[model samples]
Target: MLGRLDHVALAVPDLDAACERYRSALGARLSPPKDLPDHGVRVVFVELENTRVELLEPLGTGSPIARFLEANPAGGMHHICYEVADLAAARDRLVGEGARILGDGEPKIGAAGKPVLFVNPKDFAGTLIELEEA
Candidate 1:
């Protein structure tokens, strides 16, 4: 059902400062930042051997990340992304098994130009689940 732990997304107030923190203090180099209009957020990917870390910050007040930050003052892990072989199939299985899809239908182009889908935590035990087909 899942391939690997693709990435862990962190919701931050400032993307640049966060990237700098990861790079300078943590000795990490992010690939590049990308703006995702659909999600209304900018993201930077910290590439690793088998996985990556995604830094996500809201681009506007209406952005989902912004809303999440508002509720969670100390924004931390936003979601855990899992690599999937077939996104459509995985989505169907989850829905059939009673998991609610946070986003409609198929996945859309998200941060870093990757296809991404969000599943409601209600069905996933309070964890925002992200599925990315590799």
Candidate 2:
């Protein structure tokens, strides 16, 4: 099962601008943005009350965020990641429920180089769900 709301990820067109906007809106400090070359995106973490909001901006044309923005027209909430006690078990449950995983298996390094897994929206009610080990 899910542990807590680990973070909420947003797809943005400009990482720096989003960081400034988040800082101004939340009055919270910004964690240095990290470039995730593998995913072709950069991210900044804004620490909130108990969870951090992650701003994601594509680094290049091949970035998934870029494609997402193109398809959606407006960059917005990308996904909701929940910290789980056992990611493997949670994945198994999802699979058992007829969910299709976006990746091969298990969590892998994603934005911020954090271990994360993407579950297909088709199986999760049109919302891309991310599962991370607690």
Candidate 3:
């Protein structure tokens, strides 16, 4: 089951410019940019009182964010993450409810270094959903 909102992700063409804009215009403090090679993204988190905003840029070949950006040249919201108390249980329950899990249906280490799984967008009204173990 869903625990709480974790972070909303945005695919950005330029990570530095996105971070700078968030910092300067929105007055948001950001975490240091991190390269997640396995996930194929470079990310920076905009700290907030209630939740975090994740800015993602494509890292290497076959990056999903890169494909997303290609279709949306201006870049846009990518996905939203929710915390789950038990990732495996959540995955099973979601599967039982006919929701399709992305990837190989296994959890991956997320930006927060927690086990995470993505539910297919087709199963969630076109919004890619990430479930991170709380």
Candidate 4:
């Protein structure tokens, strides 16, 4: 149902600063910022040899990332994404196991323009899990 880790998403208060830190300090390759209005986040992907790191900043006051920052101030790890061959099948399997899916329980277009679904954090031991279609 799950494949390799897709990317680790970090909610950041300042998107540009975060990108600079990864680009200059860590010497990481980063994708240009992309505004995901549907997700209410401005995102940039730090490309790596094995995996990618997604940096998310609030797009609006109502953004979920804004709420997250309100709680953590400095921002922090928001979720971990994993790849799945069949998103609907994986979703069903998770539902059968009583895992709660966030939003409408349907897959939405993700940063990679792939179908993605988010599972409730509580179900995954306080870590939000994102399932992206491979």
TM-score of each: 0.88, 0.88, 0.95, 0.93
Q: Considering summed lDDT, which 10 consecutive residues are worst modelled in model 3?
A: 103-112
The better candidate by lDDT, 1 or 3, is 3
Report RMSD for candidate 2. 1.8
Highest lDDT scorer: 3
Whole-model lDDT, candidate 1?
A: 0.85
Per-residue lDDT of 57-114 in model 4, one digit per residue for the tens? 9996589999999999999999999999999999999999999999999999986799
Q: Rank all candidate structures by their lDDT, best first, as comma-separated numbers.
A: 3, 4, 1, 2
* CA lDDT, candidate 4, residue 46: 88
lDDT of 3 at 114: 98
* Number of colliding residue pairs in model 4: 0
lDDT of 3 by residue, 30-111 (tens): 9999999988999999989999889999999999999999999899999999999999999999999999999899998887
Residues 49-125 of candidate 2 have per-residue lDDT tens digits of 78888888888668888988898766899999988888778878888988877868767876545677888987777
TM-score of 4: 0.93
lDDT by residue (tens digit), candidate 1, 12-131: 988888988899998997977888777788989998877888888998558989998898766789999898998889989988998898857678766546677899888888999989
Clashing pairs in 4: none
Clashing pairs in 2: none
lDDT (0-100) at residue 119 of candidate 1?
92
Better of 3 and 4 by lDDT: 3
Give the runs in model 3 whose Cα sits over 4 Å from its true position: none
Alpha-carbon error at 102 in model 3, in Å?
Answer: 0.8
